[model samples]
Target: MTALRTGVTALAVLLAIVLQAALLPHVGWRGVVPNLCLLVVVAGALTRGAHFGVVLGFCAGLALDLAPPADHLAGRWALALMAVGLVAGLVRRDERPTIPVVLVTAAVASFVGASVFGLLGVVTGDPGVAVTDVLLAVVAGVAGDLIVAPLVLLPLMVLLTRFEPQRRLA
Candidate 1:
């Protein structure tokens, strides 16, 4: 990975994680905070490639796992985000995504990542993680993700594209 690409992505991810952790909790709609860090992975995957996406997802998730107030079992977010990155990378390879595609990808990725985290909690015997809440989370999470996606995506894509000048903007 290019240092420039990695540094840019890292800075963005750090800002996102801080926003998600500090500010977003107060900006939620009925208690669902958007996963801002997910956008970093998505942007990287779409603009860079699958391998970069996977690595970003894993590393970013680990940062989240290590962050304060993260009480869940470690690596859950890593696995989920890695899968999101991989899937987004696959879809991005098929075509340059339109606005609709970006929205749909954000929704699906948010839902799937949250679902996987909830499922991981269940498997790990976390009583607070209700399986039924997974459905609700999917709904609420998508709305939150949709709200932030347009705001986050454009700048992120631009930065990523700068790192990879040959990449055609979608």
Candidate 2:
């Protein structure tokens, strides 16, 4: 990737995380905060490729894990988001995803990402994380993601396209 691409991606990821941890908490549905970091990785992977997605996912997930007020295990989200990025990257690299596809992708990514994190929490002896809670989170998280994905992912994808001219889809 070009320097421009790298800078833009980093900035975009930072902005998404900031907004996700700050603004979305109050504005989102009760009990569910939007996962903008996951959306960023998904957008990067879908528009860029699998490797890009995986790397971004790990970085963003680590950032989230280390962010303040995080109570869960450090690697839980990292592993989950890595899985999300891997799956997102597996989509045909040449495909220019449409709005509906992006929405569906967000939903799937959010569900998978949250599920993996919750499962890991369970395995790690977190008494508060139950299957019922996981299911609820998946439901609420997917709903919130679908609503926010278009608003956030599209612009981020546009930035990625512009920053990495050669990677822009037809």
Candidate 3:
């Protein structure tokens, strides 16, 4: 079951990355693409725990950093998404969260992820990020993530929920 869950998780992350790379860029809102990969990590953390979220975040971010069309330094996103996972996981509860809670969490995660990525770029002396309107990008990215979160999170939550340990009826 663990192996199966791991395999499914890997496939899901890979699919998210593929979609993020291919479909999302073309349909971006206000020059910011929705981050399906970050959503996946959030779902994992919400369903599983912080540890899983952190690991998945790192792996997914690394893939995004290395994916084709990537023109920025590697590890920036890895660190950023890892931070997202950590924050989301810290906010997770044993029971399911309400819609508002989930949305707020997604917004926070989106903000943190984008901010960290942009900050890392600035720290690393990336010329593109130095001049980009980071505040606008962050706002747009958060809005985009919020807009797409329900669509992405619902299915992902269903898939990830299967990985939870079954409750024993006493």
Candidate 4:
């Protein structure tokens, strides 16, 4: 049953990634795109735990790393997302998960992820992005993720509740 739950969660994350990479980029406001993948990763970490979160985070980061228009090192996202997942998982409690929590967590994770990526770019001597640009990108990404987090979280919660009996019971 745990295996099944893990499988389902992984599948859901994959689908979310595909949608995020393929569709959500086109649905932007003032050039700010939603980080649906970040939201899903946070949700998974909140629902599961650190171990699961780290594993899933690596996978999600790998997908993002391999995505087109990639600029940073392959393992940069993996490290950043691993940290995000670990933090989220550690913070999550057994209490009822709320929209605010999910949104805030996702937003923060998005910031951290972007910051890590930006720092990596700077370290790697990517001249295109300035320090201010990295900060602005983080801010924009957080705002965008917060705005669209609930949209992804609600459906993800529903799917988790429906598919994972453990979550339903919780």
- TM-score, structure 2 vs. true: 0.92
The regions of model 1 sitting more than 4 angstroms off are 92-94, 165-170
Error of 1 at 22 (Å): 1.0
Rank by lDDT, highest first.
Answer: 3, 2, 1, 4
lDDT of 3 by residue, 22-126 (tens): 898889975579999999988887778789889989998998899888878889899999999999998847567888888899899999999999888888888
TM-score winner: 3
lDDT of 4 by residue, 43-114 (tens): 777777678778878888887777776656788777778777887777758686687777677777888877
Tell me the alpha-carbon RMSD of every candidate. 2.2, 1.9, 1.8, 2.5
> Candidate 1 residues 1-170, lDDT tens each?
48877788889988998899899989798778999988888888877777887888889888888788887788998988888788777774666678888778777777777887778888989888786787788788878888899999767888788788564456
lDDT of each: 0.82, 0.83, 0.87, 0.76
Q: List candidate 4 segments past 4 Å from native.
A: 69-71, 92-94, 161-170
Which candidate ranks first by lDDT, i.e. highest? Answer: 3
Quote each prediction's TM-score. 0.92, 0.92, 0.93, 0.84
- Ranked by TM-score, the better of candidates 2 and 4 is 2
Clashes of each: 0, 0, 0, 0
Query: Against the true structure, candidate 4 has what lDDT?
Result: 0.76
Compared with the true structure, the alpha-carbon lDDT of candidate 3 equals 0.87
